[model samples]
Target chain A: MRARVLVELKPGMLDPEGATVKRALKNLGFSEVEDVHVGKVVELELDSEDEEAARERVKEMCGRLLANPVIHSYEIEIG
Target chain B: MRARVLVELKPGMLDPEGATVKRALKNLGFSEVEDVHVGKVVELELDSEDEEAARERVKEMCGRLLANPVIHSYEIEIG
Candidate 1:
């Protein structure tokens, strides 16, 4: 199974990287960019065949290793 | 408009971060992890209404600032 995980900083979290990117885009003339948030996308190939189990495992992975419980929230998609 | 950009290292590019994560997962008992690739997800809010034009503009942003054309490839989705 292939799992795609998106780990994003939770709302209200301070994201210096996102702010920097937003400013850079504006300077580059993408002035329409009103807001920007940077996140992590982790694509993993797992040695699993069951879709439901793979999804569950990926979620566990997110909680334990992929995302920080304090500041990051994650969404999982298994294919 | 909201635009989502996924910037991924091109296949065959060395990804030390990904390698480190894979190793960490294996150490954490996720031995079923065969491979992993880490990428960047940039979510943006733009002051645009046309979805088609927003998509094009976002792609241009990816080409110009969000992604490195030599080692990274990007996909853009506008909503």
Candidate 2:
């Protein structure tokens, strides 16, 4: 199974990196870009029996190491 | 219009940050994890007249600011 996980800073959390990028874009003349949220995308191939089990394991992986729930949230896509 | 951009380090480019994360995962007991490729995902809501123009402008944004083409590749999804 293949899984793609997108982990992002939670709402209301301060993202200095994202803010810096957004400011850079604005200075670069992309004024149309109102906001920018930067996140991490992790592509992984796992040996799992089925989708359900894969999702469960992946969730555990995220909770344990991939993401910090106190400040981040994640979404998973499996194939 | 909405666009989702995924920017990744080009193949053969050394990703020290990603390697560090992978090592951390392994130490955390995710032994099944063989490899991990970490990339950036940027979600933007743009006000464009059409998808084509949006893509063009977004490409310019990536080229000028969002990504460094010297070591990165990006894919865009528009809706």
Winning candidate number (DockQ): 1
DockQ of each: 0.93, 0.71
Cα-lDDT of candidate 1: 0.93
Point out the worst 10-residue segment of candidate 2 chain B by lDDT: B28-37
Restricted to chain B, the TM-score per model reads: 0.96, 0.89
How do the residues B1-79 of candidate 1 rate in per-residue lDDT, one tens digit apiece? Answer: 7888989999999999999999999999999999999999999999998898899889888888899999999888778
**Tens digits of per-residue lDDT for model 1 on A3-60?**
9999999999999999999999999999899999999999999999999999988888
Q: List the residue pairs that clash in candidate 2.
A: none
Q: What is the C-alpha lDDT profile of model 2 across B1-79, one tens digit per residue?
A: 7888999999999978778777887788766666678999997777676889899999998998888999999999988
In model 2, which regions exceed 4 Å deviation? none
| Candidate 2's TM-score | 0.89
Clashing pairs in 1: none
Candidate 1 lDDT for residue A32: 94
